[model samples]
Target: MSTPTTVALPTDMELVLKVFPMPKDSNNNGDIFGGWVMAQVDLAGAVLPARYTCGRMATVAVNEFIFKQPVQVGDLLSFYSKVTKIGRTSVQVLVEVFAERRVLGNQYVKVTEATLTYVAIDENGRPRPLPITELQPRRQY
Candidate 1:
């Protein structure tokens, strides 16, 4: 088996959480499943939406996703998220994943990165305008 890669995200990165991949989450090939990573990314991106919308929300689009390295069991995964844009009912978040190989301590490598768009929603799942915030900058677009 090939050794897992280590990942180090940017210093400016805002991490939501650090998680360890488990063996049960692996695919038949013994690598961590892609869907597992995707779920973590979704959760990471949703953190801001919950606070900004102050209510329900749903993922509308995965604008972009690129996996740079394979994730394996025992890798310590860190999810970092940042807001890139916000509209009337939609919020765009950029998420990056960094993984530290268990065997190779002190080394970190970026494993995946993505842009996700989520829409603020009502309890009924209908889109709703996000609550305006003084901290949020006004955008012409």
Candidate 2:
């Protein structure tokens, strides 16, 4: 096995989610499943948009998803996110996942990056315009 590359975490994006992958989430190769990571990314991507939607929203599209490194069991994963665009009824976000390797003295390695779009939805589950009041700057995350 090669030495895991260590890098600094992002300072611009908000740290949205932090999770530790367990053995149950691993695959035959002992690495965490890609699908599981994607699920977490989808959840992480919505954090910022939730503030703007201020009511209800649904994931409209996963514009892009890239897995750069394999995640291992016991790795402490930190998901960071930033809003890339905000349309009248949709919000686009960029999410980056970094792992603090458990076996490598908790060194950080960027493992995944994804772009996802979410649409504000009404109680009936139809798309709706974002609330204007929520668009104004509020407390920072």
Q: Could you tally the backbone clashes for each prediction?
A: 6, 0
TM-scores for the candidates? 0.86, 0.91
lDDT computed for candidate 2: 0.90
Please report, in order, the local distance difference test score of every candidate based on alpha carbons: 0.83, 0.90
lDDT of 1: 0.83
Runs of candidate 1 with Cα error greater than 4 angstroms are: 1-8, 133-141
Q: lDDT by residue for model 1 over 65-119, one digit each (tens)?
A: 9888888888888888888887889888899998887567657878889999999
Stretches of model 2 off by over 4 angstroms after superposition = 1-4, 133-141
**Best by the TM-score measure:** 2
